[model samples]
Target: MSIHVVLYEPEIPANTGNIARTCAGTHSHLHLIHPLGFSTDDRMLKRAGCDYWPNVQIEHHDRFSDIPEKYPNAVFYFIETIGEKNVYDFDYSNPDADYFFVFGKETTGLPSELTDQFKEQCFRIPQTDLVRSLNLSNTAAIVVYEALRQQAFAPIAIKEAAD
Candidate 1:
């Protein structure tokens, strides 16, 4: 009943690290599909993620297709610029269902063949024509927050200020 952020062939260490930090804060699991651009121990990655690396739950996969096999019952949504539906249009309020947000690499997006196969599950963040695409980390945070909002930020939503 939690959210999972899946990065497909992410090429930038900083972006992945930042996303990992976001995942740690939101209590979401992170799935990284190879082949990764940088080693898991890269300094930039650690720096961007700060000291939150231990707080993040990360799983690495050798292939993208292996994700579905691992989480057969979870609902998956692929994020792409050419997606048919807007991210806000989807309902992420199911407390009993596990949701996975799949994003592409920094340079080239998810494979067209794969996206085409799951065309109905594809989603995109609205943007102006001024920019080609949003940054990978930014996009992941935006979508993750939206999903969290729809679910009323359950489990992680705090009402009282920390002392």
Candidate 2:
């Protein structure tokens, strides 16, 4: 199973860079929507991402509408704090469905109307009363790892015994 992460107007370059590294490590794809807070040419991101940026599969889109046309077969999932379904409750191991984990800007999330449009596709990470939410990159890591876990932590494998 492959994983795709969508960041809408990401605000921080460092965060985006770190997420890029994560995606590279996990063999996932990262998508950045237009009107980004920092230029994709920014040195900070490339520096933090450190030589792995090129290895990471990243795509840029002018708008949300542009994305759907390109990835018609992928399942788009909006991650928000108020989602009806917790991330844990969702089945992440469907080999047939390409999983897309979508996150909004750090300061303000996606327009409520947009989220409502895909209400059934929205999900949230469980949290305690003391915390409102997690950092965007951190949250992405959590969800991706969980999905990876469901896929049997694809990174690990048993070596065949030498005869």
TM of each candidate vs. truth:
0.93, 0.89
Instruction: Write down the RMSD of all candidates, one decimal each.
Output: 1.8, 3.0
lDDT of 2 by residue, 77-99 (tens): 89998898988988888877779
lDDT of 2: 0.85
Give the 10-residue window scoring lowest on summed lDDT in candidate 1: 41-50
Stretches off by above 4 angstroms in model 2 are: 42-49, 155-163
User: Could you tell me which residue pairs clash in candidate 1?
Assistant: none
Clashes in candidate 1: how many?
A: 0
Question: Which number leads on lDDT?
Answer: 1
Output the number of the TM-score-best candidate.
Answer: 1
Estimate every model's Cα lDDT from 0 to 1: 0.91, 0.85
Candidate 1 lDDT, tens digit per residue, 14-46? 898889999999999999999999888757555
Clashing pairs in 2: none
